[model samples]
Target chain A: MRPLTETETQTLFAKLANYTGTSLKNLIAPLDNGPNADRYVFRIQQSRCYYFTKTGKFRLHITALPILAEHARYKVWVKANGEMPFLYGGHIVKAHVGRWSDDCPEHQGVVVYSMNDTPLGFGVTARSTQEARRLDPTGITCFRQADCGEYLRDEDSLFATS
Target chain B: MAPTRTTTIKSKHATNKSGIQNSKTSSKARSNGSSGDGVSKKSAKSKRTTSKGVALGSVTGKGAALNKLRKKRRVYTERELGIPTLNMITPVGVEKPRGGKKGKVFVDDRESMLTILSLVHAEKDGQIESKMMKARQMEEIREARKAEAEKRVEERKSKLDETKEGLKKKRKRASAARELEGEGGRREEEVKGTKALKLKKTVSFA
Candidate 1:
């Protein structure tokens, strides 16, 4: 990814809002240009993630999902108490939904959060957020696209508890 | 005449050990010969390669040796070397040529912006404090909501138990009244009379 100019960043934010149907402001911020300028990446600081791309475009990484959770925009909620395995399993059935962003479109990328509002990963909406909130209760609301716990599981074998 | 004179002079020098040694070491062995002893045959081969006839005087002269030198042309061209020549006339701000192939350009290794920041620029303060504060605020709100939900559940459970107890007491009193009614005609009439009297008394009290 390449570094995105302020204009490109703003445009991308607008595109994201349009895609997910939510207002997003102060959810992301760009750092000042320095020696590390032109590096396309986003870092989750406290509550915000900064992102850019090699093509001078705005881009997002899986890790940035958590910071975006605070916005509740373009997001889906999963049961927080569920085991880590359920998250990495790449399924987002209705049983997993605790809540979701209002009117999130089907097939759009979304930040997946736990009931407690911590970001668990990213997913694609299988059902609209409005529909997921309605009476239909057995199908998937979102498709698991990426899981943050996958990295944890990868490192698990490297440092066994025993 | 000049060519014959050069050959005779070179032959005189070739008989010397230094000339033989120099020629022998200079030319690499092309093939192993099965002719005579290895040293003699190797020397003969070296002599053949170095003693090619020059049109002029003896090969001892530098010019004569140069004429005898191999005329092999290079296989690649200056443009094919892929070295970028400095463009002095162009403006400084313009993108410079990065040497590779003509149509192909080499791009630097690009990574996701977040990956680059976390891996290399971890220490730099990129408005992190404010972000943390916002997250903390969210966490506090979440905790408050959870606590409130739990409290509501507890209150509902208590109310439900109270209602269940009241229903049980009402059923017991009704069963006792029915048993009294079954005992005798006078008793049943007395119970009905008492119930009517109690209802009248309660209504008047109200």
Candidate 2:
């Protein structure tokens, strides 16, 4: 799979939160913006699974692009094969944000985490990508906004200490 | 409302008859008039009613002529007799003279019996209907009580289930704790038993 674009990383986490009640934090990867590169690689939290995509961010509410684009990529199979597309996510809606440094190799884009790898009492594992793929909800709606503002990454991030 | 349709025929005959105005007045006073009987109130049977009572004191007033007529008939029969006859004197074992005459006896016919039966039937039918209504009301009360009982039973069942679940959780925790504590003791006892048996065998061999 191609890496997730910055938009793709954002939308994936937002959907992970929407589909499950929790979302991922800091599971973002930067696309080199190299002509050959198409998107970024990001992981969603809760049900720790992985995905490669192109477009959006995790909003307090759901926004559409990354999900729409992801749907579009595998949507061809659903259209032609009349089968549902699959989901790819991970478990860490609580990944603390790291420095998104243009200076480091891994610190370029967004960083996200998974909740499943965390224990049960701590949080819950979202359903696996396989489970999400089997979901045959009728409406495959898209996003209303393209860019979602920044999300708080830590408990301290809320008040920076509050 | 007249409960029954009936026409009663009453005939007043002279029970006592005495031929004097004073006696007749007393006689009229003697026959107490039935209330609401218009004819009697009007003094309609004044003479007959008067005469009957009048003669009750004297025995020789209203029926004096009938007495004479009966005597005359008996005399005539005696004169016309062709056979030997006994003298008109009292004889032993003969049931003789009571002084007064008795009036005719009146009676109700059989059809009145049917009216009485019909009235009784109507009263009984009403009683039966009331009894049935009472039974239905009692049945309704029973059903209401049964429903109340069922609701109470269900509430009790739910409460019991909650208590059982709580007890089960508590018991599980207690048992798990006991098992952990007992583990070392049980293992130690087993080791001691094995050592004692080995010692016994050694002693026996020696």
**What TM value does the first chain of each candidate achieve?**
0.55, 0.18
**Which candidate has the highest TM-score of all?**
1
lDDT of 1 by residue, A40-144 (tens): 342223222444445645554455454455554466667755535446666777876776665345456677767776678776777555446653666777777
What digit string (tens of lDDT, one per residue) describes model 1 on residues B127-163?
Answer: 2334445545655797899999999999999999999
* Model 2 TM-score on a 0 to 1 scale: 0.19
The CAPRI-style docking tier of model 2 reads incorrect
lDDT of 1 at A75: 64
lDDT of 1 at B44: 82
What would the per-residue lDDT of candidate 2 be over residues B3-55, giving only the tens digit for each residue? 33222111122323432334544356545665444566567657655565556
lDDT score for candidate 2 against the true structure: 0.36
Listed in order, each prediction's TM-score against the native is 0.32, 0.19
Q: Candidate 1: what's its TM-score on chain B?
A: 0.28
Question: Which whole-number lDDT from 0 to 100 does residue B196 have in model 1?
Answer: 47
